[model samples]
Target: MHFDLADLRLFIHIAESPSLTQGAKRAFLSPAAASARIKALESQLGSRLLYRDNRGVDLTPAGQRLLQHARLIMRQVEYLKNEFTAYGADAAGHIRIFANTTAVTEFLPEVLAGFLAQRPGVTVDLQERLSRDIVRGVLDGSSDLGIIAGPVNASGLQVLHFSTDRLVLAVPRNHPLSTLKHVKLKDTLRYQHVGLHEGSTLLSFLREQVEHLGETLSLRIQVSSFEAVCRMVETGVGIGVIPESAAKRHSRTMDLTIIELDEEWAIRERSMLVRDLDALPGCVRALIDTLLPASGAEPPSNTPT
Candidate 1:
């Protein structure tokens, strides 16, 4: 190889972070070492690759051009490595996955169990983050794959609609809101709400629905995970709005109640995102094939009526 993969990898990190210090931290190299590698790469190409300013680093015309090609070359290298690895062959590799709280808690458990059973040697690192983090993780190379809510837009990643999940309103079993047959969007907003953090897609969707009704949802407390939101609702902190699938897990064991959000603003789609499916590691490929077969998962029975 005329240029080392490490060199291009470092460049991509620098390009994304735009800070030699931050990029070096992420790449696990000293600032001086990272700088020297870029300098050498620029020298070999006989071009100025970066412009440093008070603000941060900016890629020069040459740098931007190389980044595109470097990404392509890296994908090719990854695909080459994947080809030689066997199916279910204890392929040792890293797969960083990001998923929304609902999928992480409700859907991923069974999928992961099956995947690990087939490929025990493979390691799975999973994160429970919101949709934006999942998309950003793929773009930043922090995660290899992400599963999240609909309408996640990212230029650097390949997104697939692997599934659709419904969102519903959850309340304590004895709460007043639990009496509604099917909660309308307007009705749901009338109650004090317990919500996921601002990072969550559910929160954003709730905000949009409330706004469309010419009202604001009164969010009493914002929590990080869907589980926390459910716990809060169970404790009567306030009514919560979460994915129905997520609500189902707690429904069996807790005194919580769920109702369908009225027709106008109900169903939301969830999806799978990959940095580049063609460039996936063998273990990742196997896991994907098992968890998200071409048919995609059917809407789970847990969806609220």
Candidate 2:
């Protein structure tokens, strides 16, 4: 038996849509033509693929199996198309990168800028996600590379050292906590806090830590970025927890103080993760090399809190 990509494509469309007519519309084929294609596919396989109903169609057992393989095959086809297109476009390459807020905000700008400058033909698609989600994306082949901070379960991917940063308490210069060089999270929880907005990885981590301590964060204000949080703290709105890199940078120009967090989790080591280093395209590999530190170079230093 012989089947074409069109058959598999039509099968997937039919399986996903509420009706064959709708699927056919999406596939740019007439309803009758789509139905005929499905019938021919079923006949070739000698198995019923879908059960028709008034509302739509449901996949049969054989259809479900085929759906799985079809999705995988489509993914491979897309990859092949992109690879070939890059080759035809004068050695251009594309890389997809997913990173957490800390890595995106505090680390990647300079590194990515240099990488892009050196390799003019390479294009990057960058997305911001939580470290855990970044790990999942890399493992599922949705992302070519991931830069993450905090702890993550990176079991199946190759992990490499990327950078190191620390969480710090940012306060107005005259605030009570500013007098202290380091403080535990619990000690600062008693005061109103300026926080990153909800759904931020740093905010989520802070909330989880507070929950583990059987307490709640007394959030006075929530803002979208570290710069906003620092500004709020500088105006004495409330103390804020932010990366030391950001706090230090802001303190140079603002009346802000950075106090090191006394918890073990405060010192975060960011990591770069990939599904397989060896399988990366030449241009992608070159970009990776640029991101990595030179052999025997000093490890990233934590900002003075």
Candidate 3:
């Protein structure tokens, strides 16, 4: 019937961490004290919160439910602290945004730079995550805004057209496919590929598309970013499939050739998603405005294909 903020904070830490000891360390509590707190919290709530095993701990159903509420509560607490602190000085705000790989790598830097330039007191926490994780973060109040690509089941969120891009092949100037203006993915699958890391959204999408065609991509090297992929392709390691914007930019600096893809799914669109636009803070709303494309202007197309 009674609990403190420390208990909730500790509970969240434990649920996220692989072990109670690690969680305790993160919460700045001794292991013994943290265990005692957990026991007391469970007793007061009349439910078990974690399942113990040799590998680590897993959250119980009740613990999962509590975690959702705890995150929301902590976010509100942070907002309150920032709001009150703003009155004593220049109005400063903090906004957290989670975006997928394409948006993070190609789009957000310029948009965020312009926003930060105008509001020197405000700070933005930007993180890169897959589209699905970004959606989950926004839905759970873990992130204030999200920009995602591809088809997303956004039944419960407000969606806006953010930007559009296409996937293209980046081949060395002398590669076999360099002479073609546009080639189908199936045609390119026969050669080795320089791809992004396994968990990257663009790489996963490419794999999914290849699988859908009853084929597999022969990836020769996997790198952390598009720049690395382009660099690898430039050295004749393998061709790379990357966002058109990135390929174009790197082509100027590197001896790489850009070839468009002839697949329908290659034309990707990005959308900005939020839980509720009406409920957003003024600073967040202003950030959204800055991110949105100019009125009556068509979304910038990344490639002619």
Candidate 4:
């Protein structure tokens, strides 16, 4: 049996759209040509891959399996391309990192700026994602490394201790919670809250934690960044939960009071995650070392444990 790479790619596009014409258009192929390729692929596999209707095509069991394999293959292909992109005359090194909102907004920018200045040939693609999603992306070869905050469920990956931070409540100086030294999120849930915009990792994590407490989190106002969240909270429109660093920084200038969260999860001990460091490219390994400064202890082994 034989399979063509183009056919696999076309099939993937079709699986995503579930419409032959739409898939063909996305793949930059004529509808008839894409149909022929898929039909030929089905014939080669001796399986009927699609069930067509006026609405769209549905994947058969075999097609579903193929789609899974195809996606995995494409991800690996992309990983290969990403790893090798630095080798050409275009750049010296390239790496992709997935990190939580705290790491992206509070920590990484300054560190990455220094790294980029020293290695002008290196370019990084940093993305803000949930810790769980970051772990998944790193493990699946879709991302080179993940910087996670809070507890980490690290299995089948090399874990390195990174940094620690805290989450605290930012409230207007005269607000009800302003007098408190420490408070649980549940205690503040009854009050209107300012929040980061939708799709933020911190917002999603807060919602998940609230759901576990058998409550819902409603935002009085939503803003784009942590600074914006603090600024809104200062106006007395609502209180907001922000990083302790951000709360402190903003309190210096804004009329906001910082209250530590009386919860274990509020103490965010960060960690770095990766696959086998021994297997990564030299420049990528250098980046990992740069990100994880020495902590007066034995260095992490390049080998995966």
Arrange candidates by lDDT, descending: 3, 4, 2, 1
lDDT of 3 by residue, 46-105 (tens): 999888787778999988888888887887676656666643222457889998887777
Clashes of each: 0, 0, 0, 0
Off by over 4 Å in 4: 1-3, 16-18, 43-52, 57-97, 112-126, 139-142, 154-158, 279-286, 294-305
- Against the true structure, whose lDDT is highest? 3
Query: Model 2: residues >4 Å from true position, as ranges?
Result: 1-91, 294-305
Report, for every candidate in turn, its global Cα lDDT versus the true structure. 0.76, 0.79, 0.82, 0.80
Candidate 1 lDDT over residue span 1-305, tens digit each: 28999999899889889587788889999999998999999999999999987787999999988887776577557656655665433364556789876776667878788767766556678887767777777775567778877676677666666677778888998988778768787876767888877666567767877788799889899987778888899998899888887789878777888998776447767677776665676777677676657326642232111
Q: Write the per-residue lDDT of candidate 2 for residues 1-305, one digit (tens) a residue.
A: 67699888888888889999999988899999999999998898999999998889999999987886775566556545655664442235777889887766766778778767866767888888876788877776667788887766767677776667899999998898888998999999999999877767898889989999999999998988888998899999999999888888888888898899999999987777876676666666666677667322244232211
Model 2 lDDT-worst window of ten: 296-305
Backbone clash tally for model 2? 0
Ranking by TM-score: 3, 4, 2, 1
Per-model TM-score, in order, reads 0.75, 0.76, 0.83, 0.77
TM-score of 1: 0.75
* Candidate with more favorable, higher TM-score: 1 or 4: 4
Candidate 2 deviates by what RMSD?
A: 5.8
Every candidate's CA RMSD: 5.4, 5.8, 4.7, 3.9
The alpha-carbon lDDT assigned to residue 275 of candidate 4 equals 79
- Using lDDT as the measure, name the better of candidate 2 and candidate 4: 4
Q: Which residue pairs collide in model 1, if any?
A: none
